[model samples]
Target: MIKDIPEDKRNTFAAIGLLTVCWASAEYALDFIIRCVHERYGGSQIREAPPVSFKGKPPYLREAFANHPDLAGYLPQLNEFLEEAWQIAEQRHWCIHGSIDLRADASTFPISKIIHGKEHRQDTREFTARQIELLAGRASALSVNLIFFGIQTVRLMPKEEANKLLRELLRKYSAALPEDGPF
Candidate 1:
């Protein structure tokens, strides 16, 4: 049955799957941080996450940290990570909103978004199979870093114990978490 499929379709589908997984990881990390902040601020009274959302996540995250008076002293390394993560801003935008052109052997994706009424045609990019795979790996790494860093730096949770609990939570929620995730 698999043999009947064309190579481009198979490859594109695989990349698409990876892209979704990577996207999910990033989204989960963002939501996780948001949830933690909300709960820490006494949102626990509602027993559900608030309806708030963020645009330009990095800035929002930084601002979120600032808003939490307690975390005002969050380590300089956390600030540094946020700065480095911003470097991927273009790639992440293109991977999600861009159109993918599937040819005989690979895919090229390009993205353009109007922000503040300005056309952003500057950051267009193309991706090969290897590049897409690398992006997936990088995205996963970014999320894991966010999870660990957010817990340690933002939540002020102890690294070893917090991560151990997080790993267990991830394992337990591995099946249901994605499905239950934000759309």
Candidate 2:
């Protein structure tokens, strides 16, 4: 079916693919931050950290970092990244989940989905290749920024405090771990 698309419509598909992949990269970056937060917050291992969905991650990390004084300087950037990341997630949801019109041009690519409620309605939105590309760029930037934030957070933590936290975490999870290891 993809092969049947006309040449003019291929750019839309490509743009959509870019957005999808970029957003995935952003998610991976967020996971890195999750791992850092889990370790910093006395999580023995990532597996021991409670499960959190993508939608819940930003708020959880924001609150966690806000409680620590060392992370104060980075809060502004963290808040900005989290806010933008949330916005991007919303756009990503629509673009990835909505149905596209194959006959539409790249400049007026239409994506629509049915909204279910007391009375159902169709929600349709148009996106140009340029707009999708811009979103992809933002997603890519967010991924890079998240990685830097995690790295900085790790570096800023005092060695003694980190060690103490790790020790406590290991102790908490020790009883459940096998003799060989958590594996």
Best by TM-score: 2
Alpha carbon lDDT at 3, candidate 2: 87
lDDT of 2 by residue, 79-117 (tens): 898899999888877788899887764467888978789
The global Cα lDDT (0 to 1) of model 1 is 0.60
lDDT of 1 by residue, 1-183 (tens): 658767755665577568668857766776677677666754344335443433455555565566666666763655775664554445556666665554444444433433444654444456665666777777688777877767765463656666566566778867333432321
Each model's lDDT: 0.60, 0.74
Clashes of each: 0, 0
Q: Once model 1 is optimally superposed onto the true structure by TM-score, how far is the C-alpha of residue 120 displaced, in angstroms? A: 8.9
Model 1: residues with Cα > 4 Å off, grouped in runs: 1-5, 41-54, 67-69, 84-89, 104-124, 154-183
